[model samples]
Target: MPFWLSWAVWSAPVKKLGARPAISSGCSGVTMLNWLTAQHLVGLPGMPTTVQGVNARAKREGWEAQLRLGRGGGQEYSFAVLPKETQTALLMREVAQQEPAPAQQLQQPGAAQVVNSPKRDAYTESRLNDDQRSVMAARMVLIREIERMSKVVSQQRAIDTLVGLARTGSLSPYLAERAERANDRKNADRALSERTLKRWLADYRKHGEIALAPARRKPNMSVPVWAADFLKHYQRPQKPSAQAAYLAFQREYPGAPSLHAVQRFLAKLSPQAREMGRMGPREAKALLPYNKRLTDHMWPNDVWVADGHKFDAEVINPNSGQIFRPEVTSIIDWATRRIVGFAINVAESTLATLDALHSGISRVGMFRVFYVDNGSGFANDTIREVVERLGGEMTHSLPYNSQARGVIERAHRTIMVRLAKDFDSYIGADMDGEAGNKVHRISRADLKKGSQPRHIPTLNEFYERLAIALDEYNHSPHRGLTKIRDSETGRFRHPSPMEAWRRAEAEGFAALQPSTELSMLLVRPQDLRRTHRGLVRTNGANYFLQDLVPLHGDQVRVAWDYRDASKVAVFTLDGDLIGQAILDGNASDAMPRIVKDQDRRVSGQLAKLVQKGKTLTGKDVELRVIERPAEDDRFQQHLLEAEKFVALAHEPEADALEAPDNEMTRYDRWQQLDSRQRLGEALSDDEARWHASYPNHPDFKSIQRMYDHFEAEQARA
Candidate 1:
């Protein structure tokens, strides 16, 4: 047979080579001619002489490429893809014959014994899947020829070629041209276009061809002062028409530039004009062509993904005086399709993601893989340690590649849709504290008026309710599960997650890793700090124990600074708010500062309104106030009334304070008070305290807080 004929016969889909080819191993003395030819055919650093030799090399070097069973086992495909160098190596050694080192090869015509091109690094065999590499190689040739002619082509010809290539289904003409330059001529055989060719040269001129790594365009661009001003002033909605921008520009600069001149300026803003596009934080565009690890075969438990998303809800933020969005985090078991843990909060960021992960690991033991999107919060090594310590692999998806985490992404969608549709009711409401429960209750008429947009108390309230809603979801059954009974034990195979989890405890599934840091979270800051002799801090302010400077050097994280600020909180970085540092400031007068003066003036109006209400006795305002460490006269009076209430719930005196037929007198009182006060009038301490504190339940904390406030007011007076 002709050498080419024999080669054709040898090249037919040779099953004997197996699915995962082993072209990158072994150096057992090949004959000079075979070695040189192999080098030329594969151009790879390590090419085996025979099939057995290849397998032996692969086994010895563990370079066997992974082969995966395709969907429905339709085909066997390579799982392990390699870098470009390896692919080049494979083409040179396996596809081409070396023949003799050209007559031009002798000692590089007398240069120091030619280095032989570094012997093509041992990993030179093709790294891309075989089929893809062949296609890519063929495509490269087309790109080279296309670009070769494009540089000299006219503008109109370039445009026609660009359109032609797109019409012909070329994978990014720019990229094809790039691949052509990197690979040998034989590989550059794809269809070509003048537009693509010109673009390649233009890019080479601006950003060297090598810099155009197979990646997406970056989104970050430093906006020029003029552009920033343009964005702010550009009146026409999105991507303004040229005529509109030119007109607007003429108006802004008035004779500074004409429409024709501005249009010329705009022509400079064309996609090909700028070396880099406009900046949009660029975080999302940095990943292009995708990383091998990102696109590589990902099995469940290979990574754990974490992220926080805002859930639309009926929420009111009392502080901001407006409804704000609430956020929630979910830890999903990628393989089992289970939501392992969740945490909800007002802000969805790094700290919140940490809190959610904190809740997850504490509840579900540990996961093997942690995956999250490339958001600021999920990008921290501090947060990543949670996974690392748990022996879990951590990874962030390429920006916008939510599909990479198909399992959890689907779960997020499933839960969000289900919750939005079947959302029951918020668990609790401020109807129980701030203004006396005057929160407009959804009446029968309001309920009947479908989607009337009833008011929500606050973002905090919404989060609490979402927490409950998510819990219900975890306990819900799925159609995918099958009920099975063990042949011997007769236990059902599929149980609700909660039920299965409970049973797992009985079967030794609960083994807590007693890391000191993890265990410390159980201790509250109030008790733990005194025990540990540690100082405390909260909200960026630090507190030192009266006699505890000995421990000042030690650091801790502050957790719960109580609503009253009575005790400062401190914690270790690992989420353990285990101790408190009590405040021991003087009992004397405080020197008011400029900021405090402004604060007092700002609060003066709220005070005047609170005092406008009818003077109700402490008994009339039912509120829970935290017991102050030290006794105050007002606190004592309120404490006595609360004690009497608990003692007199069934007593006739309690009924005397109630409205006729058990109507809430306090609610009616608030309505009367609000009617008398203008929307923004100032009120006295007694009134302002009640005004702000009434919406929360009238518990001891609210009342004692009021009493403490009145005590401070009296002292100030």
Candidate 2:
């Protein structure tokens, strides 16, 4: 089914003190400007933040602003305030100008600032007295103690335990409650069911228990009554201290209370420090540090980066008639200023991304650093090892900060708009054959063919065509290079992208993939899982060819979407195609070897469907032979159908019309086929008309698309 899409909005709040206002986000800079101005109007003492701060915060949280239900039943839109700092994003929009507001009350020089509202001060003073403050501090200690029970949770008992222990510390019940509320809100927002959430909570809270009130009965431990009573009292307000315990004993006609009594009471508790993944930086504290360190892209292999954007593949594959969707990947040689290597794949993912790096390295040597966006694709180890093995570093563009890796960012657009515009039509549509019979198409009989074709090309035929296309792309001379070579000179002036790679190789540049013509495919990193041996496993099977075991559990990077068998095939890092390990398990996925079996299935399916269609026409056409689909089935059905109709009046065939046609008409005959094949197949009427319009027409993608459109319209009626 075709997926539906829509637009949404973002917004943020602004604060003002003096003439300076809080930076705003969402609809306009006015919100930011108004916020900043408002802050100035309030004459606040804190340092005034620039538009940059507002944008960063907005982007971090999702543009602050308004959310509203949109037009459709499923449509929920959020109109967020643009990060006030995103100049280009905001300036592009046409929002109303800011209205005049009050003048500023700038801060006085060298003065201490009390950054709090009078209302805030009064409320705090009234709500929390000296005793409450002391209790609050103790409460913090108790909470920490409860948290120590380990599977940490901020429950009341946990709070009381920590409060009882700390004596006094950074304990704020308000903040604690807020944090808990936020956690609950997040889960709520996630839309998980209550029972599921409770299950998760129970699992998380496995450490110690929390109680809403104090224990009714004290534990019957073998300790002195006076000492135990002292311990319990100390946890409560106005409870007895060590001195008071001794005084009480004396008053009751007793004498000896040892120092060991107090020491033993305090020694009952111990704490554990937090654990971490990498000893270097905690995930919470992990961030791009700003130390004013300047990077000039000064050295080779400094950074290998990646990013994603919607490419106008339509324009890129202009002549193509197949349903086209392509997201390209390109790696750049930072030091030499060249687009070292690239690949055009179906989606933005790590699976289809690894090959691009291999291409760059194989072509240019090794880039120092690999830079990429903070996306799941690059998060995999495939990218990490590729960069490290090349003796390069891997860095990432800050989230929403494209300027960090500006070089390759522009390179992608340059190739798409400047170099690739010529191939768009044929990339998605059938470009080769004269608009008819020889054209790649989906026929009515394809309904019974089974799977949706990735590109509708036989592997044997595609491998040949792919080689030619690669050669054409690599050798092309154009503006991206300093030298634009023509047929007249047939010479090199400045180096093109490919030529530059060749030059770099001469100077000791090493690439991952040595032979670009090996005919490879890209798979998203998601399909793969890392095994203990470091080999990448996918398709519910292990990839253990001898060449792969060395890297064992390492992920195999790909440069294209190979999810569909037609466009997808696995290869070794050493660059061997059509090879795999024998496996023993419940791996249900059919291997490419099953290609023959699948073909036979398609052929049998097509012959059966043709028979069914003939039944609709009320004729018993002689069944000549059932052909396998992979070999070629489109033309066979048309031939069979046409011949079957001819037999409708013939002597022996005339008796075949006795089969009932009240229900299964030739059109409904398509309903018997599988969805994938039906998607490519044309309706019987269109198929008949197409044959009449151009008996020898070859390409079928366009004709099938038209028939699908008509079928949809008929459905509406």
Q: Pick by TM-score: which candidate is best? A: 1
| Per-model CA lDDT versus the true structure | 0.43, 0.39
User: Which tens-of-lDDT digit does each residue in 1-717 have in candidate 1?
Assistant: 684343223222233322422232122211121112212323243455664554455445434232323343211212122223443343323212323222121110111110111111224233324543454444444445556656899656655765476546674755555444433235435444454445444544443332122221111111122332232333333546656655665456443334453344344332322212233324323422343333123332344566676664445433333434566677765433456666555666665666666556544555666888877767876566655655667777777566576656666666755554333322233223443233335522343453222455334445444555556555665333345575557986654445444444565554344343442233222223322344554544445554445555565555441222444555555655444455543233477544677768756765654554325432333333364654334345444444332332111121123211211345455555566566666666555544444444322233344457679978987
lDDT tens digits, residue span 581-673, model 2: 333222455656545888799778878988997889888655556546554544554445334322321111112222112112322332333
Residue 199, model 1: Cα distance from true site in angstroms: 58
* Candidate 1, lDDT over the whole model: 0.43
List candidate 1 segments past 4 Å from native: 1-304, 389-393, 421-454, 479-495, 499-508, 513-544, 549-579, 582-717
Clash totals in order: 75, 119
**In model 2, how many backbone clashes occur?**
119
User: Which runs in model 2 stand beyond 4 Å of their true positions?
Assistant: 1-305, 308-324, 343-345, 380-382, 417-495, 498-538, 542-580, 583-717
> Which lDDT value does model 2 have at 359?
48
